[model samples]
Target chain A: MSTPENWTPQERQLHDALHRSAERVQPGPDGLARIRRRTAVVPMWRRPVVLGLAGATALAAAVIVGGVIALNDGDDDAPVASQTSTSPAPSPSDTTAQTAPPTTPPAETTPPAQSLTVPVYYVADSGDGLRLVREFHAIETSLTPIAAAVNEMLTAPPADPDYRSLWAPGVEVTAADLADGAIVVDLSAPPTAGEDPDLAAQQLVYTATAAAASAGQDGSLPVRITVGGQDPSEPIGRTDPLEVRQLVQLNDPAEGATLPSPVTVTGEAAVYEANVLWELRRDGEVVDSGNTTAEECCTFSPFSLELDLEPGAYQIVVSESDESGGEGRPPMSDSRTFTVE
Target chain B: MVQDRTGSEADDAITDLYAAHYVRLVRLATLLLGNEAVAEEVVQDAFVALHSRWRRLREPAAAVAYLRTSVVHGSRSVQRRRGVAARHPDEPPGHAPSAEQVAVGGAAADAVVEALRGLPHRQREALVLRYYGGLSEAEIASAMKISNGAVKSHASRGLAGLREAMADWS
Candidate 1:
């Protein structure tokens, strides 16, 4: 390699070409000139403080654009599902909406809030076009335990596994909402053995709350959860067949729940399952039994039944029909008494 | 306010630096970038960055080196954008210019760009500083974060390759 000292004709000509190219460049526009002038006028130290805010604005825009693009490009077909927002409220048509037909006796209760308070709503698909619904708050993203537990469920195959984990392990969960008032969570039970079942259950709670919170309700999450057709535990109230009573608005004067709106039941029950027995009972005697079928699987059976009745301490009994045409030994439901004038 | 210096004094210094170095830096950037408009934008961006960090800039003496390095990095960005340019760092074989080719005018510039763009990002920066900005090999090496030997070798190889590809441009 010849040095610059060699005076090669080509080397010198290359140098000349560079100069010609350099000559065509214009100075930066007015904004830059203004920056020049400001830097010219301000004390050197103050320039940073001023520029810092300005720089932040530019950085904020760049970050918004970049982060959006990064998030968008992270997955081609689907954007990152924000683990936060009420994960897609199970619309009215979700197929896993098979709840027992509601036979809950509607007790004279407080009017429902103008808006329903939901902590979380997790809607997922059962690969065979069947959708499963569950909800809760504060789902964890520590990810490992959930992953292992899910793997265990897959391998163990309880009776028959309803949902094959479609999501892979280690995929980052994206968050969307922050309303932790009432959570509808999907299961976090990993398929692996020796997994902390408590943590897994809490994962369900955490995700539901986080999603509900992200969706914008206050953090006091009253949560409900469902796996397959069975309630995770026992009913919040005593009712047959419809055993998942986490959703029952337990109108306990003792519990201090004052409804600003009419009380309504929102969930899924099978058509063949005992039709929803929306009852009206005053001190245990049946006042009115408003009945409706859940009509679909994994759907939101929002029974907005209006019973014109006088009130004083009434119990609402909502129950489900089993495959054997009977209510679950203990039904899924709640009872609340109110003074409706 | 920069505590070390008072208001107007610091202002004058900043103004003087901008006035003196702005155009030359743009030209230097232009040489590496091969696009005049882009060079100016790169220079403006570098200056803005400098302004933001002006307080932490302890030594005015190193500002020129700071500016040159900024231009070099900016030129690399241009190369990334162009995609048509940047290639392997390997040197092309040297070729003598024919008598007919030596007569070409500014058309020779297009060939220069073609050859320089072919050089590695670092080698191109080294050559631009050495020949266009007239910086010494040591100065070029310091600005480029490379050793003097590396600068010498890169410049030599860059020139040799330019001789081959730009032989037709004269």
Candidate 2:
């Protein structure tokens, strides 16, 4: 019920004056140039290989939570196509078709390929009422094409570390499709990170979308992100992914577990935010990747690497940095002993 | 299905996004900060954030909205960090207003400046975007994230407040 008609010309003039003043002072070229100068592009290859889903296999040496459904489906009955060890391509007489390398595996390859499905789960603790949240889901058929995309994202410098810890470490994945397009991800815990239901739902959305893409589908695998199979009010990632690591022990990774691939990283974050980095080493020469925040947070990065480390014993480190680049978190590091043999 | 943006394609998308939006964002930030230098810094921070979370966004089209929202958040953070209050004139004109402004009368401009110093944060933002940026009510709503009703409310209240303060000055 405001009417400028009641006001004097002087009042109107004053209002216009202040508005103009604010506009006149609006930032300009000098300010923009400074911003452009500040944000340098961090080299892509230098980033760490995101854990899990590399070239379709995630690099994260996932610490299988207790709640995991243990569904290593499609992989069980299929003959374990072993590469005739380099030791000997089995005597040619071995019926191995030595080189039938079909330009296209006989059309029969379709049936077996169709069964290549993995049900991966991303579970977040929902607090009291909702013990299990099925964040997202999808069918196996829709995701195969998305592997390349997942591999592309995973290989980038800023690979996802143990983000589940942010939701709740003790929590478990009851079920997971890992496939794109309406992926169904089930978790066995309540959302406790924040009271905002949106925040809880976001954890589900991000996990589902990420997991789905890992399974392989181009465009949006619009995950029907849900809590215990129920729809949410809104999606996640409002500002930052909510800190869900509280319920789970995202702190220390398994002692002897090894990363599935080498990692590289470079990013600038603020002190308060979490800066997660995954390190890969071959023969003691370690490659570090991930962004730690510096002042003002966003910083240009120009570091990178892509290495193929043969299976063997090596040490991988997880480093956390605060806004000031002050190393925080438990600062976990350990030597892992594994052999391709 | 959102196009499966391949790694190289995504990078190009990002570069393209930066090229297209960087300047506009800086301009937006400048208006918000009331200073070009600070505006650039704010806009830069927003872009960096956009880059970091590029993988998480379900739809790449939403990127512009994300950046706009980030600009607001970043400016607020900067304000809090600098302990910025209605900016005070520490020194008069680092450059002279020149001959044309001589007739406008320094006192009237001073009165206007003082009045602006009195408005609250959201009010200032709305008014700046409305008149200065030549943005419509809907545009302001998108930028500030409030409903059109809320924006109209803020603008109305802000302009009224400015008028009252100016009356006090004269």
Candidate 3:
């Protein structure tokens, strides 16, 4: 096969035509500003020094809690579920002293300073399939971002009106460490008994990777899961080591994520001939919409569109075209709800 | 207050890089994703990630490769999400292109884009990286994380498919 250099006149014409088409496309102003907003400097939680300090603080808190347990009259069954912070608090010692213990409950400690807004990924109903709901949990920066994020995922109840967590509340993040750009996350139990373990694994992968990015890892890292000290024989969902999370999904403007007017909806899709449809709706009424082409078709490809809308709630739906070029057959689609401010 | 010179210096370098490469990178993403707005978001996202890891990137020259890799991976994610959106049948149809859009670029340009989109992902990536991106085969391989031989095959197949798709285009 000939390269572009040796291509026939027709091939050369096609190449030129392709170039001209690209030349017509240009990003709107504020592109840089938008990027700056999404990416900020890694916080103190990711730093080794602060993480060490957090460990010491946790140890001290554990000792205080142990003393509180000793003061109680052998009420060893005190529930540990009340303090649902992302960092795992140490359990109280079981050794009982000969002296009589007090009966008063321990006072709540003051919250830590400098909290980080970490995105916790949860599975929510989206049509027939599950779409990710990203909820921000503000945890002390002293807590390691990974531990805190995962801990919250396990303990914090889903706050979104319609969202829910599939991982068992008893599940715990035994340990998490970054290895060779991949995070090895140890869990106390298997994530969930749901029919598709892959989706459950994805929730963890998305949460961990997002936490990593928030902590300053520019690239999204893959996650390897181990349960009760053994790597599961089955595969766990991980960000494509060679690719980003989209693999055939959208990442931007997460569900229930708010945005400004003239919002841009972005995602990935492999459709018939790269023909994808995008529509904007408010309260089930079509506001504005358009059909756009992706970079490639018949395989995973990138798709996006920009819509101008009033400041209000709107749902953006992107779908694949059917055989009649989006005329007749039922099309497959992905949708996200976002507020325009 | 005294500030660290190295930190500020790194920030300045990234600012300069963004000024110089933002448009080019956005266009690259636009070619990969086929939407200007989404392409812009992807490019911006790449730059932000780059900013976060700028120090580790080591050499200034490596920044372009890093951005390219990020854009490619990001596009994959966007496509996957789009595929899910396409599954439900109740949504309204997308708006057709405005008359102004067609008149501005003409039908031939549209056909080229439509035909280019028809190619497989790898082939389209190879062609866009080579023709519009003006990157060498080695660079494309590096950006795509594919072998050099695979790049050549994809480019050849992509050109062949494009030629066939646009057979009737004037």
Candidate 4:
């Protein structure tokens, strides 16, 4: 490479401009801390069994992977109806099953079913276009994780008003099972193709795959969609996140979570220079505003922020910085209303 | 005593390398990836990977080379995924001047960055490594996993492309 002394004026200008463009990029103070934390965690490949149960915490930790550890002997067909009765009370036999040793036979132990959190994908309008977003919902079910997640994706209204399912209401999962390394989902009726047919199919594809992954199955499995007794369509697989997902997403302090002080906000975003901006609001009034950078820019990567706040209901909205300098479309954002006590 | 000394030596090497090169490596990655957060992650991952294989890479110079190559490879993987995601036929042109650019009033620099973002991945990588990273042709070639001749061609083509893209600025 030619030295700076040998550079032509044009080359010098280019060099100067490049340096100036990145001059403002002073990385956050937590880089070393973050790297240490990641290094400390045993890589998933080294601990495959623990990988399946990785994010299961508190209430969801009791959820048995694969859903084969039948917690309830109740009729599997009436999962919703049985939910109310089984939640508040564990039968005498269920208590015995819970205390049984690991050596006990599978046929003898029947523990009570517990609520588990499953990720459900929903469609939302990201200023530029419609894309998929996800929310974790705690559901009490005796059915497999894939079945419960698909059922919720079909039936439940998203907690966030900005998000909605493209799947028509009243549609239910007839069956959801892993077969031949792909998830096969059977629906009660064929879903009407929305404005975007591929994205519409992707809603279920993302949901089923996410549910499968959470339940310890391969998350990358293509989803085979069968409507009624009809033949299945070409298997739907996950599209690149940048194309199908909102550019900004908030993954922590889930919608309406109540927790203590020093709340940690984290999510993934693909924004210019990885600049993620945020605003905290209480009763629709802005209380705090700031910015954080994601791990990388122009593609979805993780970003996190910590906030210490007094007791109150707050809405934290995170967005991409307006790279257009106020000329292009509004920056995409995701927000959640949470409380701190 | 020998095991303890080796362990402490390893820790010292990592600490010294981190202090000396962490920020610089992150900046290099940010220039390549156009996302500071991802760049930091890429560099951090490089450090973590280097730590695991530190015994094999005892020399500081060799460790630094390992980091640069890892960052380059990591950035390439990220760009490949992004390329697939951004393959939409109707996607718009390159990035516009950001809010910070407007605030700082560095329209000229912003224009150059925007033009750079529009270049092909290899060409951009080559140019960033040469002009901004100040790496020699051989170093660039090693980091990018390409031949020295390829690096020269990519840098020349990238410079020409940037000039054309930023023609309005000049």
Candidate 5:
């Protein structure tokens, strides 16, 4: 493969350039730890040893299976129907034992319907400009996922104080459904298109599509907006995320999670040279500060860093470095507060 | 050969693969997705997936291939969901290329990377897996789930686009 005779100068140049560009990307040190945490949570049936153990003791297997089902039903009952249907009877003798435990508790504990974790989008002012930020809200309603999410986007106050809905208050989603590979959303009133009309429209598009996806519908479909029985215009589709999303967003260690040692911070950013700077603060005082680079420069890429610290409440603020030396708009930033126990 | 492998053995194999390929795979995904955070998540998900299916795929060679295929497919899903926004169309007007260009190995490299981002998804995947990943035509074909002939066509067409994009550099 290294034979020089077959290589063109352009290809060689590209190879060198690609390596130089890619060499800057360093995976976080906590990657294995993160993967281990995830793998540990995978269903026991997927592991051979666990399956072997389950095969040996039918009663024990039934109990374990029932326990897993009970736990899952507690969190979300919508998927349990399909799960029980597929794994109808792991053991013929214990079928009654297993099925009886899972079926009863849900009916007693849960209400008539299950609530969905809907991804709701809101507009936020960042150093870069106004951009869309997302928050997941557990919405309990009879409305479909699309309508429920759109309704929340219009009515609910953003959990984050800095974020807000672009749609006017009292606006409600009259109906929402997927048809012909497009999401059709009808609003009770014509929305007040804010200064950035495109972004305002995107707020609806992102929210509707995100909610639909949560319900197992295609998220990429364009959204057709109808207001007061009138079509606003052509259906609105997603804009390039880099252009529309805040330059820096802190995704993990969500706003106020309490964690053990070695807390890992992960987020996305599009900054000059892909550099993201972070400051760890407590009691409104800067405690620790450091900088890390994202995978790519001048484009949105992921960056992660891990910190080991003593237990207490702390805030981590991550931002882009000012490449313009204070000339351009201030480097965009995002932050979250969490307790380290 | 499909024995019930112990957890520690699986952990050791995963650790070895992680040490060897995690950074490179993440970089490959970053190139494909242009977002490192999402790229890392994609690669990490691939690893977790590999760990779950380890008994079925016990060989290191097969594992590496699985990781590559997983990363490729993962990146494709992200791109599909995010919807292809034209690259850098929103670079604030009057904003000059930052001084970081020198740090990334000069403007020519930056131009190449930028131009590479503009190509069609298949062509970009072909070129990246070929030149950057140093995979053979057959490997690229398998990773991309396309034919060797298709890989060749995408690579040639992608190179043409890069050459045209970087014409000033030449």
Candidate 6:
């Protein structure tokens, strides 16, 4: 289709000759079978199958909507995992917290005694705008989740091929500490090198807030970022201004966590009108699907749904529909696969 | 609910894709990677990833394009993992040229390959996808995740460089 106007007859002859030559190379005889055998069992933990496989355990996980909370100190008094007609299945370990006082707010009052995989946000340039990409980074419980996540951000590049980072070379999050109920982040250098300064700033803010939320930090804290100790008032493109919990995040069914039918999906999302769409698929076919509303919208708030399916390998995907209600762009979404027993 | 992927319609589709495109993709990969074994591995991985994400693929018709893109990226990652030069110390037996290799059979083919290999990765990819893969500029751009203009730029520069190198070889 790309014929060159200035092409020499000899060059055209060479192109034809090269094309004919490359066509002769062949793969080995068993190449097809080998590829099929290798790819036969695509693990359920892949991107589409966000939830891990469900086993025979049949533990119903109750979706804890509203806010992501830190695991309580009294392991002995953890709420008992339970099954209610309408409640989402609860993981075995989370059963003890079933009786947790709903009124109490979670705080970073105590250091985590357990490890957590904190979701760090990075920017994916979509040509039109920058979309936030999330990747879970594992941190030792000994390290504060927020601080550790920022440190990880400095060295870790986005694993997704479509996404990249704007963090300039040698850009370091010098300090990340909670004071006056806000997470103050000190950066060695600004991410001004990127195409958009606002997106670069949001990348840091979203990642920091999500990290804090994942660690069970009180979601009330706002991320206040300072470059070289100077505050950039009203950091551009601030999404969640009200509370830290405004981060649209999945708090339950931790990545790769197994679950049972009537599985409850819970996460924080900031949608146009608190609406989130959920679909359940087993073996790539939709089995059950619907929409659920979060507590509120225009900010990250908790939402929950209970899905019942016959025992099988299933992936649950949750997405926020675009406001126009037209399928213009890919909806912001998250998914996980879990086996239903 | 057990979503049975093995031996199901999805598996059948994968098998069909494997049968239809496996060799061509292998050739494509080999052209990009300059090695047979790694090309095989990269194509296999692409299929596996495709199978895993099959459900998310909005259009089943785009599977070929999807496979092409995945193979391209997979080959890039392999090259990256292997460092600047993907030197395979464990080169399998048969360093000897195949009958097919003998058939194409000349210093010109070798010179073309050498010239193609010497170009920058983007330029080489643009040319291979264009001439060898027989992709349109738009298709090449989609496969490489770049703009059409970029695709045209890379291909033109690549072809010019290849011609220059071939002239020197003569």
Top candidate when judged by DockQ against the true structure: 5
Better of 1 and 3 by TM-score: 3
TM-scores of all predicted structures = 0.34, 0.32, 0.39, 0.45, 0.43, 0.44
CA lDDT, candidate 1, residue B61: 68
Best by TM-score: 4
Q: Deviation in angstroms for A276 in model 5?
A: 1.8
Candidate 2 has an fnat equal to 0.24
Evaluate model 5: give its TM-score.
0.43
Q: Give per-residue CA lDDT, model 3, range A132-191, as digits (tens).
A: 556677776434466568768887765443345667667876555553334545577776
TM-score of 1: 0.34
Answer with 4 or 6, whichever has the higher TM-score: 4
Task: Provide the global lDDT of candidate 2 against the true structure.
Answer: 0.40
DockQ metric, candidate 4: 0.17
DockQ of each: 0.17, 0.12, 0.19, 0.17, 0.20, 0.16
Chain B TM-score in candidate 5, rounded to 2 decimals? 0.82
**Ranking of models by TM-score:** 4, 6, 5, 3, 1, 2
Candidate 2 ranges beyond 4 A from true positions: A1-341, B1-31, B53-64, B82-110, B165-170
Worst 10 residues of 1 chain A by lDDT: A234-243
Give the per-residue lDDT digits (tens) of candidate 1, residues A1-341: 33567867877777777765555444432323333323333222322222332343454335433432342323331221333233332322331332211221111022122222222212122111112233321223222222222223222222111111222233221111111223332333322322333333443343343333444432234333433212323111111111111222221221112343354434444223325555555533457775666543222234434444444454454433222222111122323344453
Q: What is the C-alpha lDDT profile of model 1 across B69-134, one tens digit per residue? A: 777877777656642232112222112334443454444665676678778877788888887788
List, residue by residue over A1-341, the lDDT tens digit for candidate 4. Answer: 77999987777878877777666566644354344333333322342212222222222323322232232222432332334233312232232333323322232233246587889999876655577999999998655677678989998888875677777676887656554345667677777654678887888888888887887766766766665524555555676665577878998988878999999999998777788899887754568898999997666679999999999898888887764443444456787888999
Task: Provide the lDDT at A27 for model 6.
Answer: 62
Model 6 ranges with Cα > 4 A deviation: A1-119, A123-128, A133-137, A157-165, A168-174, A178-182, A187-192, A209-238, A241-262, A282-287, A297-299, A308-314, A321-331, A337-341, B1-170
Of 3 and 4, the candidate ranking higher by DockQ: 3
